[model samples]
Target: MRVLIVGGSGYLGQFLLKYLLERPEDEVIAVGYTYADENAGPIDHPLTKIDRCRAFRVDAATGEGMDACVRAMAPLDLVVNCAAMSSPGKCEKEAELAMNLNVPTHLCRTLLEHNQKSEAIAPLLVHLSTDQVYDGESPNSVEDVNAPSPVNTYGRSKLNAELHIAENYVAGRHVSLRSSIITGSQPPLRPVSRPLFHDFIVNSLKGDEAVTFFEDEYRCPIAAVDIVAHIVALSKLAGKDAKTDWLMRYNMGGPDRLSRVDMARQTAEVLGVSDANVEAVSSASVDRGVISPADISMLSNKLNSLTLVSPMGWKDQMRLALGMAKM
Candidate 1:
């Protein structure tokens, strides 16, 4: 299987690349962007750990290197788009850059065009989307969307891009995974997500240090491995064996849902940290303009029903991430 991953050096992408490389049949090709001038953070990122895969320098925003990406992995069996500008604050501030990087609506359109006209094998595309498309106010919101009333521009742009892709590229086999907050180990080493650093804040409290978290946001923390496992399983799920609900879309949610405060408390509880170590900060107190999803739970793991559970959850995953941070 010739598998290609865009944003292959990102938080989720690094793990996906490593796991995909484990399969003997999979010939994985990963494309990641890096700035020549910017201080490239962690040189030893998770993407660098992938054994059987190769990561190339490419920009998803401008389509600067996609043609070469396609040429390298000619006649691809599967292509997963995990690239996105998911930061609410960043996207809100830099709208054009965010739209270009966070949601590659036009890039996807280009890929769809290539898939349609190409004599080479048309690849199955799995686009990583978000449940944040909804305001997430309801306790029970399914993947079947009523209206994507995104509270933030990041969500709004992603939802719009997905809609555009669906409307324009109707012919190809594709799936849009709509899910909640993804908790994972370190994103290898990347310079992009500084404030979004998961390990530093969590472990500080767990180590009897001070911790502050927002109180306004509520979300379902899905494991990063859970999201990738579903994508891998979906890549193999054939039409005859696959169900109707699993056809073109599915939600990649987890077992329990939680607010930002509750989630931190649970982390403290799971790690046996004291309450004093955890501090509840209001969204206003936070410097970042991160949107608080009132409730971004999932409808069902109809996708997971066809697959297995990710061995790591937030607690275990966080522990591993902390270890990685130390390294």
Candidate 2:
């Protein structure tokens, strides 16, 4: 199988690439604006080589180098979009730029056309969306029943992207995965990418003074490895025989429903530190430019009923995440 991962340099992208590389039969293409430039060649890993694994620089926001990249990696079996301008503050400050990256119509259109040209069945397009699409007033239900009312520009843009792909692409060939805040080790190549909420908590544990985390803000903090696992599992089901309804959407969130402060306190516990070192603060005390939803935790009834598979417990996942980060 030939697989392509857009935004291959980002945090989730890198982790996905690493996890997928375990499959020797699948030739993976990692595309990013900076990955190619940074490595100056193919990415180096034990399971990956220059031949079967390759990298390309492409700008998904403007479609620059998209066609060329796609042509070179033509007949792709799957395309996973992990690209996004995920920062709420940044999205609020630069709405157009955020929209371009988050809801990239041109990029999706180009992929749709590419899939149409393929001799085999259409390539499965798996897009990663955020749980933030919900207003965060309560835990979000399955995609079918819940109406997305995003409170921030980041969520709005991600929701728009999800809708755009659903409306434009072939039904069974596209799937949107709505997930909570991803927590894991940072990719060594692109350390400059935006820091995740989990990172802040982990860093705070190492700090000398107490660090404040929002007590009211809640999310289902999923581990990066588990997210990649779900994506890979879903990608394997992409075909004419795959379930049509399942292809539409899914929610990949950890089972634990936790607030920011709770997550931090847990991290401290795992690190053998006192909870007093980590302070709990309300979101109201923060001066963030963006209006965040109070809670965007999610669970998928479809997956539970269909496969009986759910994300691993956040505590165990958190331990693995912290272990990987220390590596």
Candidate 3:
């Protein structure tokens, strides 16, 4: 199988590239914009040493190098779009950038056009959406059926991207995976202004200043490994079965639902630091401009019912991530 992963230089994308290369049979092509720039942060991994894995510099946002890249990798088996300006704060600040990257209009158009020219079956497109799409009112939102009422620009843009694919693309050839806050071992190596859960925790632990976490924010944080496993399994299922059910949108939420403070305390426990190092604050304290949903813990039994990848506990995933961060 031949796979093309856009945004391969990102936090989640790096893990996806590593795991996919483990298959040995699959020829994976990872495309990222930062690869060509010298000043950009490092996206290199040990997996690049393998003969089957290759990384190319392609700007999918502008469709600069997509046509040539798509033409070269003509009959792709799977295409995963991990590219996005995912930070809610950043999206709020730069709505144009968010809409341009998140919408994925050009990328989808290129893939669909290429697939049309090929004799082989259209490649299964696996897109990553967010749990933030929900209004945050519903505790356990169902996939596809629940009407998404995103509050912020980031969520709205992501929701729009999902809607575009769901409405325009052919069924069975594509799927939009709505994921919750992804907790993973890969702590941000560079100085990230908008830190993720794991990055924020690890950075706080490594710093002298205490970090304040929102006690009201709740999410079903899944491990990066688990999410990547689901992506691979879903892709394989798409190839193995011709059923149109695989085309449907599904949420990759973990079984455990936790708050921001809970994650920080867990990280402190893992790091052998005092839980007091992390301070708890209310969502009302921040003037983020974006209205975050109180709870985006989605019920993913329907997704788990279809695939063998059962949702794992957040505590276990956090512990493993802490261990990896220390290494």
Highest lDDT model number: 3
> What C-alpha lDDT do the candidate models reach, one value each?
0.65, 0.73, 0.75
Alpha-carbon deviation at 289 in model 3, angstroms: 3.2
lDDT of 2 by residue, 142-184 (tens): 6776788999899999999998998987777888888887877
> Which candidate achieves the best TM-score against the true structure?
2
Please, what are the lDDT tens digits per residue for candidate 1 over residues 158-188? 7876776666654446777877777776555
Of 1 and 3, the candidate ahead on TM-score is 3
lDDT of 3 by residue, 1-327 (tens): 677887765777767766665665545444322233444423464334445555466665687777877787777878888888888888999998789888888778888888677756778888999998899887888876678899999999999999888776667788888898877665332222335667667778777677889898788888878888888888778883473565367888999778889888877777777776678899999998777889888888877777778766766777777674331
Considering summed lDDT, which 10 consecutive residues are worst modelled in model 3? 186-195
Pick the winner on lDDT between candidates 1 and 2: 2
Q: Using lDDT as the measure, what is the rank order of every candidate, best first?
A: 3, 2, 1
**149 Cα displacement, candidate 2 (Å):** 0.5
Model 1 stretches astray by more than 4 angstroms: 25-51, 170-172, 188-197, 206-211, 238-247, 281-287, 308-313, 316-327
- Please state every model's RMSD to the true fold in angstroms: 4.4, 3.5, 3.6
For candidate 2, list the clashing residue pairs, or say none: 136-295
Candidate 3 residue pairs in backbone clash: none
